[model samples]
Target chain A: MEALVALSIAVLTASGVWLLLRPRTFQVIIGLSLLSYAVNLFIFSMGRLRSNAAPLLEKGVQADPAALADPLPQALVLTAIVISFATTALFLVVLLAARGLSGTDHVDGGEGRQ
Target chain B: MSFLADHLIITPILLPLLAGAAMLLVNDRHYRLRAALGLVSTLALLVIAIMLVQLADVPAGDASLGRAYLLGNWPIPVAIVLVVDRLSALMLTLSAVLALCMQIYALARWHRAGLHFHSLVQFLLMGLNGAFLTGDLFNLFVFFEVLLAASYSLVLHGAGQQRVEAGLKYIAINLAASLLFLIGVSMIYGVTGTLNMADLAMRLPDIAAADRPLLEVGAAILAVAFLVKAAIWPLGLWLPNTYGAASAPVAAMFVIMSKVGIYAVLRVWMLVFGPHAGASAYFGGDWLLYAGLATVTVAAIAVLATQDSKQLAGHSLLVSSGTLLAAIGTGQAGVVGAALFYLISSSLGIGAFYLLIELTERNKTAGADILAVTWEAFGEADDVLPGEEEVGVAIPATMALLGISFILCALLIAGLPPVSGFIAKFALLTAAFNPEGLGATGEPISTTGWLLLAALLLSGLTALIALARAGMKIFWMPASTRVPRVRLIEMAPIGTLLILCMVLTVQAGPVLRYTQAAAEELFAPESYVESVFGAPRAGELPQEAEL
Candidate 1:
């Protein structure tokens, strides 16, 4: 289970990093978004891999308590996803403003892009 | 019924956050209302700060666990924890006061710059207060981004060619630094499996020594991000140019930006590394010492070469930061204590100094008044009269008063005796030379003595050179004759900051001593951990955080 989750993380992160190297502001923003998703998923999976098991501990169920996934990492991942979404939106607005004010969205042209 | 004890944890963070939200409700573009609101909120923060400072003077010096109501009683390291120790509380107070001053200063200077100034400044306060109080690594990052986003707008408040150009560079570098910060936190999380700082402090010491190289790398990278933010050494070149063009209040407010980095370095290093293996195994702090020394020497030279008012003040800040960093690198309990003391004084001193610089810059006195003064002071002052005094409002046309203020500002920053600048430096130098404490950078008493002596002497020389250049041109030399009038609103914040600085110096015995104690708290945070997360769970998380 760890191996499968690790493989998925590896693939997603690789793709995201590749996209991040793109030249345009739009592409860079997209890459950042993708990377954020990959990170959120990767962190969530770190609490020990669980397959087909519900995260919640059920009442009186004969379950391997040792196999239960850690809830902390799951919560952390949820928070990160929300924050990244806000950041991405803010970045988008900044990008649009930069393009409007300076006639370009590239990092080099305008001194105003945040 | 006991509001201070019960609500202390979240009050500093909540006040500015809620105020910023409520501010949006009042969209009156009138400067008077905006200015009043800004001042009232600032005064509220000042009250919060003083109350917290009083609490720190108690036996604890900082609260342990459960001082205030935790949100929903989830407890620390599980739900968000807001713990205010002596150091964090003091920083919140000082940063808030300076921020408030900047807002007042801005109201007078940029009457047409729009309502964003008040909102952004208030939000920035939220970020500053939050960073000081947060116990989680991710929360620190969250607060940092919040402040930086607001700063991006403030830095480019005018959107002029210079401001925009500077803002662009500032944003790009900071964004990259933010990314580095994220990556570092992620790496630590990947290793330790938790984000709670107190938890990480406990767990870090337990990590096997042989496989701990990754921890160093992660710690260093995180340190670098903060260092970049603080504008230390190679990473700080972008600061002077960015600051040179900002409006006075905006520039003055940046005094806190450097403190944020210094706080992070000191916080993480003292809390995570001192008790753990990082300090001893990595450079034995020799590199930190050298970096601090280099930053000081280089910055002094740069300040000497600078011509502009804001730019000169910028160099002085770098020098102060370098001094503080060097003291931290010494790693002695005494040195850290002194460094903490210096941090408080310098943070306020630089803020006040920056406002002074802005106040003067705005006052562009006409060449006529400058020449008249030059002639009056030095009996026609050599053969350098290249311009004539113009016939205008004789009492300085509003702008000349600002220039006069600049001379005072330069004197204050230069560390001449009687001003707070001198008092601030005296404390730092005394700390560096203390015979029994973090005493003498591991060298013989005499050898270390000379090094301290040299640093003190050089700082004095730097001040004198800067004064001669600024004074001769500004007060003694003929002005260019066509100066712009500086506003009264601009001078108010600068004056307030300077007066506060004077008060800090006079009461140095208590303030400096408190900072020293706070530094000790930072260096040995066993109590900090217990105060953050309950003693029971304190041992559970952060080892992976040092990853």
Candidate 2:
């Protein structure tokens, strides 16, 4: 299970970086979203990828530390996801504005002949 | 007053947040009320920051190293903590001073140029304060995003073609950097099982040798994110364009933004990788030195090539950042103290220069730059008609104020005599050359030291030449320039900032003492760790608090 999750993250990151280098703004925005997803999964898996384990403690009840999954990474992942989502939205609006003003999708504000 | 003092550590962050939200509900047309609100909030922040600095300036082994505020009354290492030591307090004071100046300057015209201008400024201040005071790494990330969001809006505040274009590149690059920050942070968390900075520091030394390489990789990636923000060369290519394109007040506020990266590097590196970190001691020091020297070299050359005063200011920021980075790379306590002093002087100068650029360019024709360059390139002797020169006319009052301000700004930026800039550079150089308290060691200066010294000296010289050339064109040339209608509201902020720099020069003795104490506290992390962990949780005795 850990191997599968790690492989998926690697693939997502590779593709995202490739698209991020592309000249188009839309591609860059999509690339950012993809990169964020990979990061989210990576942060989630940092808790050692436990299966069928309780994530929280019962009130006034003692629980074995080994039987429970690490919960901090999950919280961290949640925060990362929310921030990335907002930034991606912000990036889209900026992309549209840049296109409207400069009349080009290229990142440098110049028309690419290619 | 004592009750307020107990919570003083959190006021710098919360006051701005509440003020910004309140300003949003008021109608934009009610500019007077909004401006008043913004002023009150910023003034309060300045006062609060000063109080915090005094509170944090206590010597080591004092009962309370600083005031630590834990949110939600949770236990240490679990709840979010805001720790204000000497370093954080010093930064808070600088930030609050800059924000107040920018707020006052923006009131003249820039605030009306966009929606929520005052709110955005307030939010940016909140982020800066939080980032300075937070003890958790993840909380720092959250604050970083807050500031970046506000900055993006501010960069495009005027909605000009140049702004939109520059804003596009700026947003994209920072988005990528944010991703890198997350990956690096999470990787470290995975290795250490902790996100609190002091907790991480405690855990670093105990990590097995087998996992050390992963830890180093995470740290290096994290350093990359910071270096980008710090405007280190190659990674900082976005700064000149973005800062050059931002509105004057926004650009002025951004002078502290790059320093945020420097502060983070200093805080994190000293805490987690100091001498106590076993194998990770001084990790990435060499890379920091080389990168800083390269940034300085490039910025100096680039400063010469720019005709626009705003771009020149941006490049000067890169120079300041580079010098600080190199100073940090030296791993010497005295040098870091000098760097802290230099940081204060240069940030104030650059902030004042950004505000001054707009006023100085108000009356000049758009084509004046092109005309000047053309005249220099091909000798335009025909345009110099005889006897039409008004060389001996007394300068207008407006022109006089602008000229004096411009000259003072030049002196401060270029590290010339009779200003804090010269004092800062002299202190930095002397400290670099003589590493005091090293047990009478006669070791020669390393090759890196020579390179750093050369970089610092040459950058200063380059700034002097560039500013002289630019100033001559703006203030001394025989161009058909009209006297700008300067407002007292506008001119007062610039005067205030410059006066503060002069105050720094006059009070250098006491300020240097404070910074030296702060630097000493920084090199010794045990005190910081103890302070964070020693704070009492609500409803519990101090001695009962535990992880």
In order, what lDDT does every prediction score?
Answer: 0.68, 0.86
Candidate 1's DockQ:
0.15
The residue-by-residue lDDT of candidate 2 on B1-547, one tens digit each, is: 8668768889998999999999999987797899899999999999999998888888787825447888877888998899999899999999999999998988766777678888898999999999999999999999999999988898987676677878988998899999899888888998998889999999999999999988898888888888888989989989988997888889999999999999999998889898789999999887887888889999999999988787899999999999999999988888899899999999999999999987787666535764443233112211222222323333359788988999999999988889999888888877777786445548887676688789888999999999999888888872566776677778889999999999999999899888888888888888888988997775544564221
TM of chain B, each? 0.85, 0.93
lDDT of 1 by residue, B1-547 (tens): 5656577767777777777777677766564666677678878888888877776545553456453334545545566666667788788888878887777766544534544577778788888888887777888988998888778888866554455645766765676577667667766776676777877788776676663676677777788888888777888888887877666668778888888998888777777777454433323266566677778788888988877656777887887778777777777666666666666656666676676654343334433453342223222211222222423333345555555455555556666677666766776666656646544456555444455557656965886788668766654553554454445566667667767767866887887778777877776677777666552232234333211
Worst 10 residues of 2 chain B by lDDT: B377-386
| Top TM-score hit | 2
